[model samples]
Structure formats: C-alpha cells, structure tokens
Target: MKHDDYDNLNEGTRSRIRAKRRKTNLILNSLIVVVILLIGIVSFNIFFSNDEGAADQNGVVAEKDQDAASRDKKEDSKDAGKKEDSQESGKKEADESESEEEADEESAEEEELSDPIVTEGGSDANVKQTIENPEWKPVGTTQSGEHTTVFDQNAVDWQEMILAYSYATGIDKDNMTVWFNGNGGAPNTAVGTISEKGSDQTFRVWIEWVDGEGWKPVKVEELIQNDQKQS
Candidate 1:
C-alpha cells in the first residue's frame, strides 16, 4: 500500500515479498509472448487458406470458360460441315436433272424416224414398184446459205446426189452403177438413174434440196432398165 509501511516491514518479509513480485512478472511476460505467437499462427493460417480457396475458384472459372469455348467450336464445325453437305447435295441434284433433260431430248429425236412406204407402180413404163418415205430426212450438209444444183462429177453436190440415190433405192454405193444424174422438172430437184453393178436392178431416184438439210429423196421408181444409160 504505502511506501513508508513497506519500508517499516521486517527485512526477511521485505526480501520474500520482492522475490514473489519478480516471479509473477516473469510468468506474465511469458504468457503474453505465447498469446502473440498463437495470434500470428492463426492469422497466417487464415490468410493462406483464403488465397488457396480463391485460386481454386479461379481455376474452376477458367476450366468452365475453356469448356464453353470448346463446345462453341464444335458447334461451328458442325454447322460448316452441314453447309458443305447441303451444297454438294444440291450440285448432285442439279447434275442429275441436267442428265435427265439431255436423255429426254435424245429420246425425242429418236422417236421422229419412221419406215418407208412401198406401192405398185403404174403400167406406163417398165416400172416395178414406187418407194416413198414420209419420215425421210435430208442428209446433213457441210454447205451453207443458198443452194445451187451442181452436176460436175467431182463436186460435193454430185456426191451427195449419188448418196441420195443409194439411200432411196436400198442399194449399196459400192455395188451400184450411176448411169445418169441431171436436173429434174423443177428447181432444186434432180433425178438419177442407178443400177446394181452386176444385176438388172435399176432405179430412178428423185431427190430435192431442203434448206439446211442436204439431198432428200422424194420418190424412187424401180425400173426394169436404166433408160438414161449412154450407149
């Protein structure tokens, strides 16, 4: 309490009291140091734990973003593949349609052809039969524009005329002999006398020029003799 009272105490009691105070102070200081160390350990654990948790959270977020991007890429690839497939399919269908159209055109062209007509000839001359074909098409020509009847043996028109005669009379060109080729009764018309080389199968073939088509045989008369043959 009072310094005068403590100083008036006995020497042995003063010495014991002073020693007790020193021990109590030392124990208090040691307890304070232990409390400080405990506080530091707790703070360090809390800070590090929070940092690890944040890192784990960031990692989860990053993983989710990567997964989303991968999914988007897959979707885009699928869309591109689908677009390519659609284009290829359309092209295939167009090609098939064009091919079908071409086939139809070819079939239509083939349907236009028909057989020839054969009938008995008049008794006016040595005629066997009359041959006519309504579906007869002119032989194709290399010539263009206005047509003129050519009678020269080396002319293209003359060669075509002989071809028409062979076509109408059903005679092979190699086995037939052309006796005459001259102008008929009308313009753009010609008559030819042809006979089988080694036989008496003679015919008078009448042919006419048709614009774009070459020589078209209009009539064919099977003759018993080549009346136009030169002596």
Candidate 2:
C-alpha cells in the first residue's frame, strides 16, 4: 500500500494490524526458543547415555579379563600340583628300585657261602668223625716268596695253624684248648689237636700250605676222647 493510502486508513485498523504482527512475532520467537531448548536437552541425554553405555561395556570387558586371569591362575596351580605329584611318584619308584637292588646283592652274598661235608670213619680209635669242605679258601698270608716251616712256639705258622683248626672245627679261640700243635707226616703239612675249654670233645685238624695261598685246612677229625690233652 502507498504511504498516502496508509495515512488515509483509520487509526484503529493500523493499530490492529500492528498488534497482530507483534503477537505473531512473539509466538514464533517463543516456539523457536522452546525448540532450541528441546534440542539441547535431547543432545545432553544422548551424550550422557553414550557415556554410560561405554562405561558399562568397559566394565564388562574388565570383568571378562579378570575371569580369564583367574582361570589361568587355577590352571597353573593344577599344573604345578601335577608336577609335584609326578616327582614324588618318581622318587618312590627310584627308592623301590634301590631296595630291590640291595635285596639282590644280599641274596647273592648268601649264595656264595656253602656248608661243610661231615662223614664217619677215622684212622684211630680216638678219631670219631671227619669233616671237609671243598669251598674252603686259604685264610690269606702275610709272608710272600719262599715259605719255610717253623716249629717254634712264637712262630707265625703256629698261629695260622690254630686259625685253621678253629675254622675247620667251628671252635673259636676263646673256647678251645690246644692240646698239641706239630708237623704232619707229609711235607708242608701240619696237625693240631684241640678240645673245648670245659668238655672232653676234641678235634685233630690237618692243614697244608699252598705256594701262593696261606694255610688251608685239608681235613678235620673229631675225637671221641681228649687223649692228646695235657694235664
């Protein structure tokens, strides 16, 4: 409209038009502000929700890691326990093997020793029984090289003869009384007559010396009486 026409219009009409425009502008401004506020609230809620979701996901991941670690620890402990048990079992087996080896050695030693042979018949009336052992070995000798028979009381041969007599008759030195110790009829041979300390049981032992070996008992005759005993 021209300014002349607007000036020709009544005041009431102009006032109403201005008031309508003012009301419309006020409503539009208020709607815009409300829409902006709603948008801001939605954005805030979305941001907070996203942050909370991320936190929950991280927490789940952390929980899974902890569970995995715990399982690994338990498995390691089980493995360690099995290793210890295996070691203990191995130790027990080794001990059993050692015990078996020891038992075998002891059995072998027992098999090496043999019993003597006892029989009847003697050359004299005083001789009752005879004894011999094929398994008997020399008691060993300290003297080497050439050997000479010594008849002295303090001779080494005499002491060794007594040992042979005791070995053949099963009579110890502490319980036996020597009746006679002298040369036998053959070369490199000796004879000894002995009796128990408090009994009439007597024995005559014949021993021979080998070139390299010591005195070894050849025969033992058990006597019926202590006829060779002195005093």
Candidate 3:
C-alpha cells in the first residue's frame, strides 16, 4: 500500500508537464514536414535532368540526319548538272555536223549549176563545104598561063559554077561577062566545044578586071571582101 501521489500534484506542476509535451510534439511535426519537402524537390530535379538529356540526344541525332540528307541532295544536284552539260555539248556537235552536211550539199548544187549545156549536131550547117557545080573545075590554061578555061556542058549549072569560082578565088563573079561568038569582044578565042557529063555543048567565057591586078580573061576565084580567100 505505498501509492505514488502523482495525481495529487499541484495544478501548476501538471500544467507545466502538459506544456512540455505539446512543445515536443510541435518540433517533431515541423521536422517531418521539412524532410518531405526536400524529398519532393530532389525527385523533381532527377526527372527533369533525365528528360533534358534524352531530348538533347534526340536533337543531335536529328541534326546529323538532316546534314546527311543535305549532302545527298547536293550530290544529286551536281549529278543532274553534269548530265545537262553533256547533253548540251552533244546537241552542239550534232548541230555542227548537220550544218557541214548542208554546206556540202549546197556546194554540190552550185557546181551542178555551173555546168554548160550541149546539144547534138543534127541540123549543123557545116554538112557540105563544096558547091554542086561541075563548071568550077579548070579544064585548060593558056600558053602564057594568064587565063584558065572553065567549061560546063550543062549551062544550067552556070550559077553554081560562078558561085564556086568566086568562093574558090575570092572574086566578084558578077562583074564578069560571057559571049558565044569569038569575034564578039576582046580576049575571045576559038577554043573547042565543051563536052562534059553528056550535057549540051556550049561556048562560054568570061572577062574580069580586078583591082590591084591586071585584066583577067578567065575566072577570078575570089574577091577581097569575101570570105573565100585562098589559103
């Protein structure tokens, strides 16, 4: 029966004990709050650091990939430019070749144009060079060799004979005269009858006076103004 007298303490002592307990409880609560706030701040910092590192890594990878794509595009552009340049050079060479071919064709055309045209000699006027008269042939000559006797049996060929004689000697036969009588005029002789080609017999002669020359009792072949000069 030795009981403690704690319940019988005075009011002031009891009040002092209660105040001590309350003060201890308040200090413990404030310490717990400060610990909890520090933990939250540390966790948030860890999460932000990790997220920032991952984002920076992704950004670096993206930049590298973009650089690679840019390089590839540049190479492709260079290749395209080279292809265009080659095509342009080839086109120029082809154009030059075509121009040369055209020039050659034009030169050939000009050469063809410069040629001369010729025709056949079917209607040539140089077919016959002699007359169709037999009286142009000399039958005899005088003893003095001054006169030649030209005779034709057919007097119808007298015109051709005169033309032939004029052509042969370059003389004007129109100035000459002929007579059948021996006593008709000067320089008339009694020559024999002319019998040629079984034609009609006739006695005819001529006399002509040529300039710069003596009187010609026979045929004078050509004149100065004619193209029948003796070669």
Report the Cα lDDT for residue 168, model 3. 33
User: Can you write out model 3's per-residue Cα lDDT over 119-220, one digit (the tens) per residue?
Assistant: 222112321121122223332221343443334534423343444333333345564333221221333222211122232322232333233232233422
For each candidate in turn, the TM-score is: 0.50, 0.53, 0.42
Best model number under TM-score: 2
Better of 2 and 3 by lDDT: 2
Give the whole-model CA lDDT for all candidates, comma-separated: 0.86, 0.85, 0.47
Number of the top candidate by lDDT?
1
Model 2 lDDT, residue 211, Cα:
76
lDDT for model 2, please. Answer: 0.85
RMSD of each: 7.2, 7.8, 27.5
lDDT of 2 by residue, 194-229 (tens): 887887788888899987778998888888877765
Top-down TM-score ranking: 2, 1, 3
Looking at model 1, report the run of 10 residues with the lowest lDDT sum: 108-117
What would the per-residue lDDT of candidate 1 be over residues 95-193, giving only the tens digit for each residue? 999999999987876555435678887334778888888877787788889999999999989988888887777688888888888998899999988
Error of 1 at 14 (Å): 50
